[model samples]
Target: MATSSRSASTPGWPVSGAQSRPPAAQGAGGWTWALTAPLLVFLAIAFLGPVLLMLARAVSDAELPSAWPQTAQLLRDWDGNGPPDDRLAAALGTEILAARRAGTLNRVANRLNYDLVGSRSLVYATGDALERGASVRGFADLARIDRRWINPAVWTAMRHAAGPRTSFYLLASVDRRLDGDGRIVQVEREQAVFVDILLRTFLISAVVALLCALLGYPVAYLLATLPSRWANPLLILVLLPFWTSALVRTTAWVVLLQTHGVLNEALIGMGLIETPLALIYNRLGVYIAMTHVLLPFLVLPLYGVMKGISAAEMRAATSLGAGPLTVFLRIYLPQTLPGLLAGMIIVFTLALGYYITPALVGGGADQMVSGSIAFYTNQSLNWGMAAALSLLLLVPLTLMLFAGRYLTKSVPV
Candidate 1:
């Protein structure tokens, strides 16, 4: 065989193999970078950056350490099994004098009081007692001012408060804590708020999702089964809410569902009731408004999925002597499962984060996790607790989203 000499400098190829390699690599890399840059920037600015900043604030313990670094450090070594050491007492005394001189004692006391009810008066009294020549020997002297000061539980909380950083806000969200001896314990029933809020949030979300699915299923079927001209217009109407501002929609619902609104007026006109019912400021109004807002989310997904399904299979089933209900249950319904699941996931996830509707329509008992988050953020200015609560909400939401995806993949079309 005559070996044709393959010149490295061939015009069709490259002078060296290395010369060809770089262009291919560069093209691939350039495309990857071009595709990924937007996503990375979006995540950095929108998702990851905010989340990290919020998480940092959750454990910040900003006020305590900024006010009394020495006292905080002294408490670090405290076992909290019994009285704190004299060094801790002295450190507290020193910090108190310094805080008083700096005029930050009241601010620090106020900050602590936000976390622990009545802590402001306790800290102020402790400072006064120290100034009046109270013995700075041990926790016993601190207890003389407020009996709660002696409790191991109180000391544990103090140690956390004195930290350069702390997990108190995170722990408190789940009704958990490091007790006096530094052992994790269930928070007292009266202090346990998050668990109830979490449960209520999930319960409300589940109810909304179910209601949406039930109401949307028939509507989606109608849209899918109808003529395209009619279905398209109806679909536009269904999606009309998306174009409107959420606040406006919620406010409209508030006005419409109120006792004196059109609904009650109609009821009275029809002689359905003797008097106007308590509709707006309750769970019933919350459900009504949320269902109205979220039903489209359920319908669109289901309608889209149902639209793609071939009608021939259902026709074949019907031709085989299968009844209408039987054909729907066996052939049609199974195909709509993906839509049902997607709608449920969307409705449930959105409902979990609902704030405005519940705030406007629901009473205190119906308030969801998002309402609690807003309360911490706006009312209390407790960003740490707000972030922790938000994180708690995120976990289950992420799980549900992934579970939805998994279901979509595993379920047969």
Candidate 2:
């Protein structure tokens, strides 16, 4: 009593009780890699790679040792707690004279002088002052000519210059030190700078963000409530600033807000004041220009959210005996919170990186982190310190963005 065999047309596969299926090549997962390959490649080149390279420079002590490997190796065994070792001193003396003969002492001096005030001239003058056949004794005699060389600070820095690499610049920015005796200590309160700059940057960014929200809210609401024909045109007007360069816009503000500029002239004509007010080159000017530049960032996000909300919600609240303001506050405004948060974050982050407007319009007191970064990178050529300051800015910017994303997710639609 053999069972009959199933035909090819059977519902199940040839094997009993097994379902028929397409080949693995036909599955959705087969296309996943092909679709996401471009994104993976883009992130590697455009994001992660550059960030790692930039961060490396913060701790990179490249020049002083890489060029003089023997001198660096000789100094490695010398305990920096006391005067330099005779062997280490002899090697340095030789290197210094050789570098001087090659007309390259200025390069080394320039590198060391980055964080140290007035060390360039000291190095240059010492190099020129060296006599033929002069040994380590002459270099050590530098203390007699300049009392500053007697301080342990310069020696501590020289010890750092003998390293494979170091975090000295990063530590110095935070007012911490790796002393000649190989101990870390807090610098004097007055000598600490990065912490103050960080606080100032945060405060300025927060203020500018708040001001943008205040100015943009009413404009966003009006744009959202107006008829499409009117709203579209107004939105174009609001977005007009994007068409112009940021530098041009900042410069325009400088011209308008100057002591005797159009604003003052108009105020004087209207008899609003007895004399021209101090509008430009101050914190007030920084706030005004930054807010103006950042307002559209606030408005666009908020307008998008507001436009999505149904007028019926407000109408329903009003019909239930809630006042207009109450309806907006309890119903409409709650829905717009996500957008407001998003706008605030964007504006704040942009303001934190602001250099041009603040530099051109802001007085000495109003300069932001970016201005400091530029000063170090360009004028002072202290790449390590510049990188550290930049990293300082990046931390908060990243945290704010993360918080914004979390807030957006937790919001109720």
Candidate 3:
């Protein structure tokens, strides 16, 4: 008998068939982290780095504090109710001359303008006098460039702007600002724009999410109940648009809904109307395009939940004297609640930040929070306001993302 010796730790299996043991535990554990290290570094550099920079910029102090240190020291001690004193003007003039020689006056001017609308011109005029070798001895000589420098509002704005940090951008997001004394206060009624835009963003997103739910639920049910051979093709159709370019799809809607485009032309030729409908470049267009684009997001979640439900559950419920409605409401709907919530949250959050579709298909009046963020960043060059608005949009999405996971875990499979 050819018998093989076995170690005491070995299981009672054929010796030749035993699996080979690893030579090192360290390679399996440490090498796994080594493989993922590059991805972690890449994510830190590409995503987290920019987000941190944006947040830092959002709370950054006004440039006046650094650009004119002497003026800042003076402003720190002076009573804001007092006049634009000669010492304050002399310090600003000296700073402006120094800044012009250093070629960084424009940045200071831009910062000043953020505090007072016409302060940019004031800074520039002072800078130009200094650059042209005009001798400015004191506040009286500096006021020659602009009489507004002696004005109380200009001094008040300058005094308030001497900051190491500020909450101005964050406050402005909700239609608030600092008063002359640096106290937080509500903005004028006409200037109260973003709160309305924020509300409109929520309203539009809610409507689009509801539309997706209403239209997608039945289609998802049909897909789940159908045979796989039929359901596969239907599922492909649902996913087809999602695979296509979002820009292209939004553009297609513009063409179809435009006054003289395919849909309007076809309707006119069919004698359906005398004039083309006002569909494109309005809230109607925004809603229709957003709902279509988000419909698949809702469908996929519901379909996954529906497919998991056993047919035996329904039969058992019916045998227990449950009607069709009763079986669905009592027996099936409970199982699908997690999916329903997941779909709604996904659709709503996505719609909240939708920029391209709304910009392409919607009028200015129909634009959302994302549009305002873009306008502030690109057109107005207000990075702080843009970053704060982005925070507003991001916070809600983060909350919903966690809430979806918690709710999904709570539901019975």
Candidate 4:
């Protein structure tokens, strides 16, 4: 009665205790976000911002526009029905001279080279002619400077690359290209490498995951089943890899697996073989080094999940006339599925992006997509192709990540 001034029935008054609690809850949530704002901002800037910029480069065609704006605009306006007109030709020559003088001609040349072989030479030669005051009054004069100028293929390459945005890099990543007729087609057999590399990436990841699973399960089981007095030291050993640098670990493998290294020496001393095994710098070496590097990743999660499993269920199943194998297969294994899948996914995802391990231990045939990304980034200086390859690598890894999460959640406990 004393509190009747604000009753439940009163409009704009709280209906229940739950409703009255909302302001404090909202205040708490606001404080939560306030506390986390710095971390969120850090992730956005440090992680998301660079990733987005890289992905944008996959579709970006800014080089031509940046270095040869007049020519890019003229090319955009020209219909691809025939060769560019004298006006476009003159504009190209003039801009080529300007770009060459400005030291940005390589930008335009490299972009066109992505589509047409020897286009860099074409662009450089033409720019050199124009810089020396060779007249380019018409398409014919421009064509005289380089016969490629008369070829529709070169014009088509220029037309495709004269964009603010393009799918050229993305298509090329998957071993496809846009032809002069603008039709999507497979790249030449010699150039059709990325798809195979992608497949090899998946194959290597799957095999490594499988190997980790096969090898890790027993180790994790031992860690889980052993008494704490005995398990602590083993657990420490399992976690030991985390304390070491991956570079050091991979180097250790290189030391061990090299032809004249410890393992081969030991094997030869035992009269196990007449020659040193081809253990390093091959797919076998890749598998060995990667599995060793990644084994701990698979074991730790599995050990945690395995420890949570109750012995009572196994006892009950055994008392119900179930054999040891049956109890394990029908009871123990299913419970471990979530962690098993989770750990394998983590291993596989990490393997897909592996660079240093393969680079140090694997041969040319064993190189993964990350190698191509590095080659483009460092060697070829093709940022668009690098970003495109990174994008392609991300797509499947993202899908596998989601699938792993779903399977981990959906698997029956």
User: How does model 4 score by TM-score?
Assistant: 0.93
What is the number of residue pairs that collide in model 2?
0
TM-score of each: 0.84, 0.85, 0.86, 0.93
Ranking by TM-score: 4, 3, 2, 1
> Each candidate: how many clashes?
0, 0, 0, 0
Between candidates 2 and 4, the TM-score winner: 4
Query: How much is the lDDT of residue 367 in candidate 1?
Result: 89
lDDT of each: 0.84, 0.80, 0.85, 0.92
Candidate whose TM-score is highest: 4
In Å, residue 402's CA in model 4 sits off its true spot by 1.2
Scored by lDDT, the top model is 4
Q: Is candidate 1 or candidate 3 better by TM-score?
A: 3
Q: Residue 20, candidate 1: how far off, in angstroms?
A: 17
- Candidate 3 per-residue lDDT, tens place, 53-105, comes to 88766677657777788888798788887575787777878888898788877
Tell me how far the alpha carbon of residue 103 in candidate 2 is from the true structure, in angstroms, after superposition.
4.5
lDDT of 1 by residue, 160-202 (tens): 7876678887898999977655667888888888999899999
